[model samples]
Target: EAQIMAEPSGNELASAAAKGDLVQLTNLLQKNVNVNAQNGFGRTALQVMKLGNPEIARRLLMSGANPNLKDSTGFAVIHDVARAGFLDTLQTLLEFHADVNIEDAEGNLPLHLAAQEGHVRVVEFLLRRTPTMGNKTLPRARSPLPYFGVRG
Candidate 1:
């Protein structure tokens, strides 16, 4: 009975997504749960989803999850996808129209994060899709991708 009066939140959805539990996630989506609701950590399901799973991203995006929503850390899911070298997941995000150039709290783009992590494939991909050309301005003086052969 108490469960009926509980406030709705995306904790369950985010948990399922973080665990890659497609079944449970689907169940929640079918119930018309708020796809954009923040979890206990103040992050949307798409924000905290398993970064390596494109299928999870696909389902969430199809279910009305906002790919561009930032978490408490001022990071969109693409930032994590890039930093973690999840190429397929990054592709999924792009297909959903996530802003490739979205800046993090530190004012670094996903490209910067991917480059910093030395994710060569992700860097190459971002370089092709990012619209800034070579003139992207950062809050800091230099790129974090010295090892990736990138100049500041």
Candidate 2:
């Protein structure tokens, strides 16, 4: 049986993303590093890529990064982009097929996160993107209230 090699720590990937070092990121990816590898903090390069350079994040996605890969807390890259109000970044991830209705461990979706963080643009985008969007499990009072300028 062929032995499966351990994935490299995500530190370099994360660092390259953090600094917008696309060259280094491209090199690491060429070396077969796990694009979805998580760091000590359980954050993958794509997860935190939203925090800094969206272009790098987009490139990573093009390099086959899993947009739906969740962190330790079960939050996906889309969730972070939603919370951060990065509409362009959010669009990039969505274009890469990030599930807009994907829920966290607690069953909160990207719309819920955008609503909670008061990212009106993201909330509106999600609302338009998923017209049938409904959090039936979340009580009406606990539903997406950011659009109404209220917190649940």
Q: Could you tell me which 10 consecutive residues in candidate 1 have the lowest summed lDDT?
A: 1-10
Tens-place lDDT digits, model 1, residues 1-152: 43553444689889999999999888788878899999888998898888899999999999888888888789999999999999999999999999987889988789888888889998889878974644656444445557566555
Who wins the lDDT comparison?
Answer: 1
What range of 10 consecutive residues in model 2 has the weakest lDDT sum? 133-142
**For residues 6-27, could you state the per-residue lDDT of candidate 2 as single tens digits?**
6556998887887778888887
- In candidate 2, list every pair of residues with a backbone clash: none
- Please give the lDDT score at residue 73 for candidate 1: 83
* TM-score of each prediction: 0.87, 0.81
RMSD of 2: 5.0
